[model samples]
Target: MSQSFAIAVVGATGTVGETLVQLLEEREFPVSDLHLLAGRDSQGHSLPFRGKNLRVRAIEDFDFSQVRLVFFAAEASITLEYAPRARAAGCSLIDLSGALPLEQAPRVVPEANADVLDTLSTPYQLASPSAAATALAVVLAPLRSLLTLRRVNVTACLAVSAQGHEGVTELARQTTELLNMRPLEPRFFDRQIAFNLLAQVGVPDDSGHAHSEIRLAAETRQVLGDSGLKVSATCIQAPVFFGDSLSVSLELESVVDLVAVREALEGATGVELVDAGDYPTVVGDAVGQDAVYVGRLRSGLTDDAELNLWIASDNARKGSALNAVQLGELLIKHYL
Candidate 1:
C-alpha cells in the first residue's frame, strides 16, 4: 500500500463505471495515475476526469501489474475473467458484482460495514448489495443502531437504470415510441417497461422471491449483523431512469418515537429526513444526490413497536459507485 497509488477502473464506459470515475475525482483520492478500462467496443471512447479528457483502454490490453486498486464495475463474466488477474497482479480488487460470496468476501457498504475492509487478507473485496439494497441498508442502519430490528419488510421501486445504459435507453425509447403510437416491444426487460411497472427484476428462487428481493433481504441482514432477523422483499422495475424508492416496515424490540427517529435520521451520515407537508420526494429528485432521502415516517396502526418509512436514493451513486469509492477511502484511511 502506498500514500499515492495508481488506480484502475474496469468497465469504465458503463453507467456505474462512469459514476465511479466521477466520485473518485470528486473525493480527491490520492491517485498517482488513473487508468480507465473498457470493453473493445468502448475502447476508443473518451471520458472527462477533473476537467481533463482520459482515453479509454481496452481491458484486454490494460496492464494491472502496477495498479494498486482496481474497481470492477463490469459484468460478472468480465469480473470472473479479470478479477483473478488483477488480484494475482497484487492489486486490491473492489467488486461491485454479485458473483462473489457474501460471507467470505465481506459484502460491504461504507456506511454500514466499512470495518470489513480493515482485515482483508485477500487481494479482492466484494462490495455488498445492489443499489436498492444499499439504500435500504443505509436507512436501516440508524434504526438498527437505536433498537433491535426484529423484522423488516421492504418493497423496492427500482429504476431501469440499475440495469445500465441499455435499460435506461430502452425505457426512454419505448416511451417515446408509445407516445408516437408505435408498437412497443420488450428488449431489455421481459415485458414492456415504458410507462409501466413490472413486479419482477430477476428470476424467482425456490422460496418464490426474485433474486433482487432475496439479495435485498440477505444483504440487509448481513449489513445489520442480524442473520436471525426476518426480512421479506418485493422488487419492482419502474419506468424511471435513476434512483430507487423503498417502502419499508420494521418491527423492533423496543418502541421508537417519531422525534427520536427524525433526529437519528437527520444526524446520520449520508441521509436526509424529509418531514411531512413537504412534497413527497420522487425518483428524479433523488438522482445524482449522494444522501438517502427518508420521509413519510409513520407508526403502525396496531403495533407501537412497528415503524414505517419511505426511503429514496440515487441508486448509482449512494447505492453503488459513490459507496464503492467511499469504501476505498475507508480502506486507505484505516487499513492501508
Candidate 2:
C-alpha cells in the first residue's frame, strides 16, 4: 500500500456510512481520494469529508477503477450486486452486511480476528457480524482466552436506530402522538416501539427463536472460534435511539475469581470496565464511543464458575462502522 490510497464508501449517507467517514478521518487512514456512493434517492446531497464537502454519487454511475478499497455499509442486496465487481477490479472489499456466510467469506472482528485479515488476495472480502454478536464477542474474548467457554445466554436490548432512520422517525412520531393522547400507527416495526419493548426483531422460526436471536447465538460462537459452545439469545427492540446493551451469563470450564475476570476485561482492547459503584453507563453515554462499556459485573451465586456482566456500545459505530473501519486499517497495515 502507498502512503495514501483511493477509497470508496458505499451507502455513504446512512447512519453507519456517516460514522465510517468520521472514523476514517479520526483514525487518519491514508486516503488520497474519497468516493461517496449512495442510492439514486441520495444523490446530489453532500457530506463533509476532511474539511470540504464531498458530493454523493449514484452507485451505478460511480467508477471503481481508481478505488483501492471499498467500505460497504449498504443493504445486502446492494453489496451482492457491486462487491464482486469491486473485487474483480482489484480492490479489497470490506462489507458490513451478513449477506454472505462465513464459509464463503471471512467473518471478522478486528480486535479478535486481525490475524485472519492479514492475508488477502486481489478480490478478498469479508462482512461484520451483527451488533449484538459484536458486543457479546467483545465480552467473550478475554474469557475465551483464559477459560473454556461451555455455554452463553444473552438478552440484547437494541435501539431503534438499528432498523435505520425510518425506525427512529417512527418512534419519535409515536411518542409525540401518544403524549397528545392520539391513536398510534405502526410502520417500520411490527408493533409500537415507543414507550414499549418488543422481544422480536425478525420473524420467529418454528423453534420459537427470532432470526436476530439465532444470528447472535451463531455468530458469537463463530467469532469466538468455539463451535461447540452452546448459546441462547433473546433480542428486544428498545425505545432508545442508539447503543446496544446486553446482559450476558457465561458458563466456563473452571472456577474463576471476580478479580481475575475484572483484570482480563480491563486489559482487553475495545472494551472499558466501568465500576458499578460510581460510574454507571447508559445508552446515551455509550453512543459515539468506540469502546464497549461494561459494568454490573457479578458472579453467579449458584455456580462459582459462572459470571454475568452488562455490556453496551454504540451499535452503529463500535458495533458496525468502527469495526469495519478498524478492519480497513488492518487491511492497509497488513495487505494493502
Candidate 3:
C-alpha cells in the first residue's frame, strides 16, 4: 500500500479553500484523512471530498496536531492567528494569504522556485504567491535566460472574485440593480463597479502604492529569486467575475529577439502562448484553466530592448488553490 498522511484544509468553505479541497481529490493526493475547517460563521457547512461530504468545523475549536500537513487558504488574519499553533503542533503548512513575512514563510511557486524548497528543513512553512505574482512569475521565470531583465512593469486587471465571495455577490447585485433601472448603492466596494474599472484595488499608502501592487512586486521579486529586479506593479479592479488579466512590459539589458521570446514562452511550463494575430481573454481562455495564457507578443515601439505581452489566468485556481496543492505535493515527496 502507498503511504498516506492526514491533512487539513483551513477556511474550507471559501472560494480558494473549497477549490483546494476539490483539487486534492482530483489529483489523488496521498490523503489518509481530511479535516475541513473555517471561521465560526462558516461552520456546519459541508464540502464533498472523495464521494463523502465532510463537515467544516470551526478553526478555533480544532486541533492542529491531528494533521501532518495543512493548507491555509483563509484570510490573512485567520492565517496569522492559527499558523503558529499549526507550526507548534508540528504541521507543515502552505499559506495562500500572503500574511506571513518572507523570512518566516518564504513565498513559493513550484514552477518558478521549486529549488527554494531544498534549502529548508522539516516542519516546512511556505507561501503561495498572490494571484498576480504567481501568474507573472510563471511566465517570467522561463524568460530569465533569454533576456537580461532590468525592469518589469505590469498592469494587473483583477476580477471581483479576488476579493472573495462578498465581492462577487456585490458585483452581481450591482449589475442586476443597474440593468433593472434601480438605484445603485455600492456595498463591498467604495464606488460603482458594475461596468467601470476601479483604478486601484485597495487604499494607497503614503508612497501612493496600493497594498496589492506592493505585494505583487515584492512577491514576484522573491519568487524569481532576484532581489534587485525592478518591478512596478499596478493592480486594477475590473468588472469581470473571475480570472485576472495582466499587461506586461519588460525592460531588458539588450535588444530582445521576438522569435526567441515566443519560443521560450511556448516551451515554458504552466504557460500557454496564444496565436500572434489573436488574443486570449479572461473569460474565454483562462477562467477554468491552469496555464497562464500569453498573447500580443511585441517589442517596444521606441526601444528594442523592451518586450511586451498580455497574460490571462484563473486567479482562484491556478494562482491560489492549485499552487498550494502543488507545494503540498512537493513537501510530501521530498521535504516531509
Candidate 4:
C-alpha cells in the first residue's frame, strides 16, 4: 500500500521551489495534503498543485507541525531565520538554501551520499548542496569507487540562474539593452554579465578564492565522504541562463585505464556519459535535462593517474530541486 503524508514547500514561488513542486507531482510523490509558503509579499499568491491552485501562505504564519516533510527552497536569509523553528516543530527538513552553515547536519547530494541517511538517528534533517556543487559532486562520485580520488581541481562555468530568476532576468535585460546600445545597469551580479563571464561567482575572501569556489571544495569533499581529499575550485559566472558545467581534473591514488573509468561513469546513477565522438554542451544537451551530461573524457597531459572531463546539468532541476526531491524520496522510503 502507498503511504501518504502532509508536505510543505517553502519558497514555493521561486524557480527551484516551483521545480520542486513540479517534480513532486510528476514523480507522483505520496502527498496527502500540500502547503505552500513564501514571504509576506508573496503570501496570498496562488500556485498550481495536484491540478488546482494552492494558496500561498506566509511562512511566519504557517504551522510547521502540520506537515510531516518540509522543503526549504526559500532565500537563504529566510531559511536561516525559519529553518530552526520548523525543525523544532518536528518536521523533517530538506534544506536547499546551501547557506545552511550547521556543522551537525550533512549537506548531501543524495546520489553521492545516500549513506548519510544511515548515519542520521532520524531523517528529520538534511541539507543539499548548491546547483554548481551538485553538478560537480555527482560526476566525481562514481569514479571514486574505481579509483581513489586523491585530489581534484574543478573550474565551474555556472549559469546566471544560480542567483535565481533575478539573475536570469538581469542577463536578458543587460543583453537586450546592450544590443540596443543602451547602458547596462547591473543589479543581480557584481558586474555586467550578459556577454561576459565573471571569474568570481561570489564575494571573495582574503584567500583570493570566492565563497562559491570555497564551497565547491568543501561540499564536494563532504558529499564524497573524503574529508581530506585535496579539491580546488574556480567558479565563473557564465552568461547562459539555465545549465551549469564543470571542467574537472582528477589525480587518483592509482592508475586507471580510459575504458575502465568511462565504463564506471556510464554505470553511475544520475550521470550520462558521452564519449569522444559525441559532444555535450550546456545549452544544447544539458538544459532541461535532469542527468549530468559528461563528455570530453580523456587522459590529462600529466599522466595515466590524471583524468579530465567536462560535465553539465540543469542547475535548477538536478542541482537543487531534483536532489532535494531525491532525498525526500529517500526519507519517505527509509524513515517516513
On TM-score, the leading prediction is 3
* TM-score of decoy 2: 0.95
Q: Against the true structure, what is each candidate's TM-score?
A: 0.94, 0.95, 0.98, 0.96
lDDT per residue as tens, model 2, 1-336: 458999999999888898889898998889999999998999898889889999999999777888999998988899889987887788888888777676756767876766666555656687788888987787778766677777898889998988888878989989999999999888788878889999888789998998788778878877887778899799999998888888888887788678878899889998888975644355546888988888888878889888888888889988999988888887787776
- For each candidate in the order shown, give its overall lDDT on alpha carbons: 0.83, 0.84, 0.94, 0.86
Instruction: Name the lDDT value of residue 231 in candidate 2.
Output: 95
lDDT of 2 at 83: 85
What's model 4's overall lDDT? 0.86
lDDT of 2 at 111: 68
Model 3 over residues 67-168: C-alpha lDDT tens digits? 999999999999999999999999999999989998889999988999999988879999999999999999998998888889999999999999999999
Comparing 1 and 4 on lDDT, the stronger one: 4
lDDT of 1 by residue, 1-336 (tens): 348788999988889999999998888988889999988988679889988999999999878997888998988789888888888898887888766667655678777776666567646566647888788878888766677888888899998888999999999889898999988887878988887889889888887888788788888878877789899789999888888889889988888787888888889888888867563455546787888888888888989898988988898898889888887887666665
lDDT at position 65, candidate 4: 85
Of 2 and 4, the candidate ranking higher by lDDT: 4
Worst 10 residues of 1 by lDDT: 276-285
Tens digit per residue, CA lDDT, model 4, 117-146: 887865378888878789888888887768
| Candidate 4 stretches greater than 4 Å from native | none
Q: Which lDDT value does model 1 have at 1?
A: 31
